[model samples]
Target chain A: MRIAAARERKHDERRVAIVPDTVGRLSRLGVEVVLEHGAGAAAGFSDAAYAEQGATLTDLAALAPDLLLAIGPPPGEVLDTVRPGGLVVGLLGLATDDAILEAVAKRGLGAIALELLPRTSRAQSMDVLSSQASLAGYKAVLVGANLLGRIMPLQMTAAGTLTPAQVLVLGAGVAGLQAIATARRLGARVEAFDVRRAAREEVESLGARFLEVPLDAAEGEGGYAAAQSEEYLERQRALLAERVAEADLVVTTAQIPFRQAPRLVSGAMVEAMRPGAVVVDLAADTGGNVEGSRPGEIVETNGVRIVGASNLAAELPTHASQTFARNLANLVELMVTDGELHLDDELVRATLVVDGGEIRWSRPA
Target chain B: MRIAAARERKHDERRVAIVPDTVGRLSRLGVEVVLEHGAGAAAGFSDAAYAEQGATLTDLAALAPDLLLAIGPPPGEVLDTVRPGGLVVGLLGLATDDAILEAVAKRGLGAIALELLPRTSRAQSMDVLSSQASLAGYKAVLVGANLLGRIMPLQMTAAGTLTPAQVLVLGAGVAGLQAIATARRLGARVEAFDVRRAAREEVESLGARFLEVPLDAAEGEGGYAAAQSEEYLERQRALLAERVAEADLVVTTAQIPFRQAPRLVSGAMVEAMRPGAVVVDLAADTGGNVEGSRPGEIVETNGVRIVGASNLAAELPTHASQTFARNLANLVELMVTDGELHLDDELVRATLVVDGGEIRWSRPA
Candidate 1:
């Protein structure tokens, strides 16, 4: 089996699909690794380092491999270069991106979209969403603390005593839980909210208070919160405003994947916050969970700083790339049995979007 | 008794001598407070906030009071506005800045320089240096962590395990000790070094290892480490290089008041550090302890980031201003007994730089 690593095409996307260490891991599995020149440069991995791990490097024009590993869906022009029936693996988001699925079907490519990986104990090792969300959540707290006018920890100095900053994390997913943990590590008093009652234990385990809204459970598919009724969302927003007003920092990570992110924080809630309070909206790229969040920008709305941070995982590229590459390797390892590609595994069946010259949509359970 | 505050005149100097909360503290002492209209604006305390605390707001040109409280020495023209024989208090470096001392002497202004406060148990409450350095130390860790390409804490994910970052702090003084504590709180393995043997206990108490260098003790007057000989400094540099090379983040905060800060980390040492290593020099304003550091700037040399972070305390203006104001208020409280200025206490005598028509130079022991 042969695999090629492709450079990420998105602007400011520094994460590479594989690191030098992962290149070495794949080579040990009887796989021939190929890379386009400078593929891992942005992630602090050099071509020479890849060569030391028994990988071959070549220009895109000279690149033709049996399998292509990417961070996102490969650009259309690059997909044209892949041999017909060759495999393409990445966070293809085929369920949401119709155009990518159409092109993959036209090219007769075998596409494996990691985002469709089932949330099961067996598939946990190949979960890219959880790995990347962990990094984003940690980075969000750092951004919020840096922009804050007050220090995070309480200090009792010779002059006086300063109270610790109060932090609130909205949503109790992987990202929100990580934010709560990071904020607690910095000595901030943290609180978290979630529509799912199951998230309450996770929030409390991280030394944070779980905010209760007294609403019906809105648990969604795949262990995520499903879309809520309009009335529930309105009441949830009203209850959250009182907590938001008392917080010195709020990190919003309420994302619904393919749909627009639910608005959890309102404009009036921001106005009620103390001057110099900071809000980091991680869902800004998919329409923010905060009322006034602008994607990829920091804006001040009535003395509250709203930082719409998109692609926060890219900010910590070294570790993010390292963790993500392992996830990719685990999925590829399942597909190749005894140095031959085998798609009979149920995991492969669930993730395959394009195979055998047709778009194969398998709804993930 | 009446006191007025002058707005800071230095570029990027945002901290005010007083905050609204402290205005009420002074009011109870029967002191009528006057202010320059926008003195507290940069620190997030509005003019109306001060007025609500019974402070009278007025333009700087019309400021005439019995006492002037300031962060830095007021410009000569502004000093001339004060009534003759009136008192002035702040972090006025009278031991240095001969020009300012001369003007104070010529103008017959009663000046109490906080920089000269004795390092006694009783004097600790009025210790402005210790109070401000605590904020600077906390911020240095935050700035270093934010700029580094890796996360500070050890993370265990489904993909793999990441080791914690290694941190080194030089000069285990108030600032250095706080930096070590802050970095440890963020899950970094920290090490510290100080010429004073007494610092070893403080460093170890904070859950950080104390680096041992075989050398003679160089303890100095007023609880500060004395200057070392040329040969001693050279030998110390060689010993520190090995440790510096191993650290992911190094924060240097060694300084002698009114003297050029000691050169602790050499340029060769920084070059030997791994790529993406960060070195934050908190002594940059008084001649940085790191060779390549420039005041108020962040630069990269040989792939090592050197942040010349002078005035780091001012960056967190809200808490910085609050703590600093309380320190000033404590010193002022000792001067006024029964609604009259009483300079009989030795604490005031030691802090007073210029009294009557003569410059009273009291060398703090």
Candidate 2:
């Protein structure tokens, strides 16, 4: 179907919906690709590249396509260019922003949020959050490595054998695994932990050690960790005091949907660790896993440095934009037909959080 | 050589250096084992069981074995019972404690800390940290699942299609991978990341997608991520903001040796996420990955919950203790013989952080 990919309205976003390579892939799937001029410039894709790939180069007003694809929710002015009854798809956080919801409703536009897609096996290929989070996870480690003072792997040189840096990862999702594998490859002794009992094998298979504890039954369900009872937490703290004190580096990535971050690290724990240890808090933006964590700030306490960096994925814009563009392309391939659009696909239906001019799935309000 | 298995000093520690079954293995190696009353109680092993397996039950004062085995460092009074020139092996953080070092010297004893074992191929079996960390990783996800407010997997119930929770893991080490696999088994959509590019395959092999990024050539000699320029960090942050905003749950696990945690998440990024989201910082002990994280406290900001619970491994102490005991047992099997000890093995030499010692391997002044 015909889709107009507009420039991302969010400042500092280098990603674009329709990269040149994706335009060719979409063209093969009978889709007409439209690009806002220079949309892919920040990502190193030129407008001419889009034209070479058979995409129609046109202004937003001239190319009033039936569907709009964007990296984020379209800006207000850009929404004005949509034809009536058109569909717009992107990362629409409809639960919080009334303005965007109101804008879509006023125009009777069908809007779907990639972020709102239900996480399921069948929907995995169309999941944008997975795609982007993977990128974020990969980047977060690099950010941490760059900021850390010492090297990760052990080295035997004529001067002396340099012991590998000890790395502790806090979570075991995609990003955490990547960090573990990455750290291990770099010769760093990597260790990680998560709240999922089922994660032990995967962690061990990677050659990294897993940290275990006697968690309350309430701490686990269906393999995912549940919010712990206060008593369970106290016991956890008492048991973990020594382990935390021994680690050289720590990375924390633990979060639950639409909730505040769980405090896993304490000031006492930080105090217990040796000075100059670095912690990368992936949850800094949401809150932090560390006691003195501040988003986008480097905090030093008792000679220990805590860096709260936000948007780790954005740090690697080139690859992030490429992956995002590919994800968008896959999503478009699911609904495009003969250079036109079909909004009836289950993939589209499921992710259509704001359709028929109303907020259909608003995270239970 | 002969060795004495002592009672655990910590009240909750139930594991002994040798289980009944393993005692058979040790006896075959010409090792004589002595038990001190109730060493294996927590692991369901009785002194009779050890005796049945060819271990001798003896009083500490009479045993005066060449090797002493216990779950933590040998208590001060217990050191007095060791024969001069005897060996003591366990999970000892001697480098961090002057008391432990002094005790080893005062007693003229050879002390091997399992935690200090080098991350070498030969030391794998004796690696206490790896064994325990692996279990900790598995349990962390279970803990998170128990604490999570929703189910991990998708279900097609007659009521409606239940959506799987979106789980984001912060680190990619052993604990992180276990968390990913555990979450996946429970039906949650799991995503993970790490700094080292080498982790991509491990993450993908587990059915989770790996996030890729454009990283600088900052990897250290052992494939560890080396520190990067500030410009690189800014770029990274800009990219991760959107991904963090979309995740329902985030688990952070990033730490550097001898340093404070690096802040991976920003407050604005957390604010950007939908309310009611949850974050668990596994690095809560050494500080956290979230901005407003507090150790052992669940902080809510603008409708989001931040849980900074440290020492997740301790939450599953029963299993943790079991694994730790197994590791200790394996280590004890390496040097104890005929109710005696041998301290000349390469493994012992490398792990003996304090032996007739005075800060054997002190941190740089």
Give the TM-scores of the predictions, in the order they appear.
0.90, 0.49
Model 1 C-alpha lDDT per residue in residues A3-74, reported as the tens digit of each score: 888778888888888888888778777778888898887776778888998899988766676788888888
- Per-residue lDDT tens digits for candidate 1, residues B96-183, read 5646777777888888888888989899988888988998999999999887767899999888887899999999999999899999
Residue-by-residue lDDT tens digits, candidate 2, B1-365: 66677776754454566556567766666766677776665544667778888899877666676677766777877788787787777866443454676688777787777766777777776676665555445445555544443345453321223366687777777667766765565556877877666778888887887765565455546233333656655665666666677666777777653356778787888888654467777666566777888877788876567778654544444344445555666666676665455668888777777666444656435
- Model 1, position A138: C-alpha lDDT score: 90
lDDT of 2 by residue, A195-214 (tens): 78578888888788987766
lDDT of 1 at B189: 96
Clashes per model (N, Cα, C within 3 A): 0, 198
Question: lDDT of all the models against the reference?
Answer: 0.85, 0.68
Model 2 gets an lDDT of 0.68
